[model samples]
Target: MPDKPRLERQAMCDRLAMEFQNDWIVNLGVGMPTLCSNYIDDSKEIIFHSENGVIGYGPLSQEGHEDQHLVNAGGQNVTQMPGWPLFTMQIHSL
Candidate 1:
C-alpha cells in the first residue's frame, strides 16, 4: 500500500485562498474554511461572510486579542474590516 501525501491545514487554506478573485463575497464555513481568511492576499478585496451574521470581516483574531462581540460561524473570534456589520439570523417556521 502506498501512503498519500496530504496538505496540512494551513497549506490547504492557502491553496483555497488562491482560488478566489478580488471583490468576491465568500462564505466561510467552520473549521478549515475559517482559516482561509488568514491566507487571503492583502491586495484583494474579498468579503467574508459568516453564518453568525458577520459580513465583510477580516482574518481570525490572534489569541488574547479577540473582540468580545465579534465571532465567526465557528464561534471563533475574528477581526473586522472597515464597514463590517453584524446582522441577526432569523429562522422562519416551515
Candidate 2:
C-alpha cells in the first residue's frame, strides 16, 4: 500500500478545532491542544478554558508579546478575550 500523507500541525489543529460548536466551553489540554484555539471560527462564541484557571481566553501569545499573567496548563502564555475570568482551585487534603 502507498504511504498515506499526514496532516501538518496547523491543519491537524484546524481539524480538531472544528469539533467545537458555538457557545460551548472547551478545555484545552497541554501542548498541541492549545493550538486549536487559533483555528476556531471567529463567528463562533467558543470559550477556551485553561487548567491553570484562565477562562474565556483567546489564542497563544505571539513571539515577544506574551502577557506575564496569562498561561495555560503547559505554561505557554495565551491571549485574553472579552469577559475573561480568573479563578483558583483549592485542593483539599484527604
Candidate 3:
C-alpha cells in the first residue's frame, strides 16, 4: 500500500492554535490536544489548563529535561509557568 501523506503534528498544532483568542482559557486533553500548547501565539495570553491540576503551563518539555512530577493528562511531561497553581480535583467544586 502507498503511504499516505499527512500534516506533521507540529503543523496540526499550529493550525489549531490559531483558533484561540488572547483572553481564552483552554483545557487540553491527552495526545493531539496536548500538542496545541506548543503552537499558541506568543502575542496572545491564552491560559493552558491540564486535567491533572495544571494551569497556566507552557509547552511540552524538551528531551532530557522531562520532569517526572509535571505531566499532563496524557502522561507527557509539561512545563509550568511561573506562579502557576496546582490544585486538587476537589477545588473545582468551590
Candidate 4:
C-alpha cells in the first residue's frame, strides 16, 4: 500500500481551544466537529453543549478508560460538567 497523509484530529482540537473566546457557546457536531471541543481554553467560559444535555464536556478520554454507557451523540465517552443536565431532546432546534 502507498503511504498517505492524514489530518491530526488532536491538532484541530488544540486550534479550537486556542481560537474560541470565553463567551462562546459552541456546539460540537458529531465526528470531526466534536473534536473541536478539545481545543477550548480552560480559563475561558466556552461551554461545549452536547445535544445529550451535557453542558461542559471534558477532554477526550484515553484508550482503556472509555465507558460505552456514557458516550456522547458521536458515540465517544466524554467528561461531564459538574452540574450538567441530561435530557432527551433539544426544544430550541425546533
Who wins the lDDT comparison? 1
Where model 1 places Cα greater than 4 Å from the true spot, the runs are 1-4, 86-94
Writing each residue's lDDT as its tens digit, candidate 2 over 1-94 gives 9999998887899899998998999999888898888886988999998787788988889999999888887788888888887677799999
Best by TM-score: 2
Q: What does candidate 1's lDDT look like per residue over 1-94, in tens digits?
A: 8998988998999899999999999999988899888886888889999887788988889989999889888898989898886567789999
TM-score against native, each model: 0.81, 0.83, 0.79, 0.65
lDDT of 2 at 9: 82
List candidate 4 segments past 4 Å from native.
1-7, 87-94
Q: Which ten residues in a row have the lowest lDDT in candidate 1?
A: 81-90
Give one digit per residue, the lDDT tens place, for model 3 in 9-64: 88888899999998899999988989998886778888988897778888899999
Q: How many Å off is the CA of 73 in candidate 1?
A: 0.8
Error of 3 at 35 (Å): 0.4
Question: lDDT: which is higher, 2 or 3?
Answer: 2
Candidate 2 Cα errors over 4 Å, as ranges = 87-94
- Give per-candidate clash totals: 0, 0, 0, 3
For the record, the alpha-carbon RMSD of candidate 1 to the native fold, in angstroms, is 4.1
Better of 2 and 4 by lDDT: 2
Cα miss at 79, model 2 (Å)? 0.6
Clash list (residue pairs), candidate 1: none
lDDT per model, in order? 0.88, 0.86, 0.86, 0.69
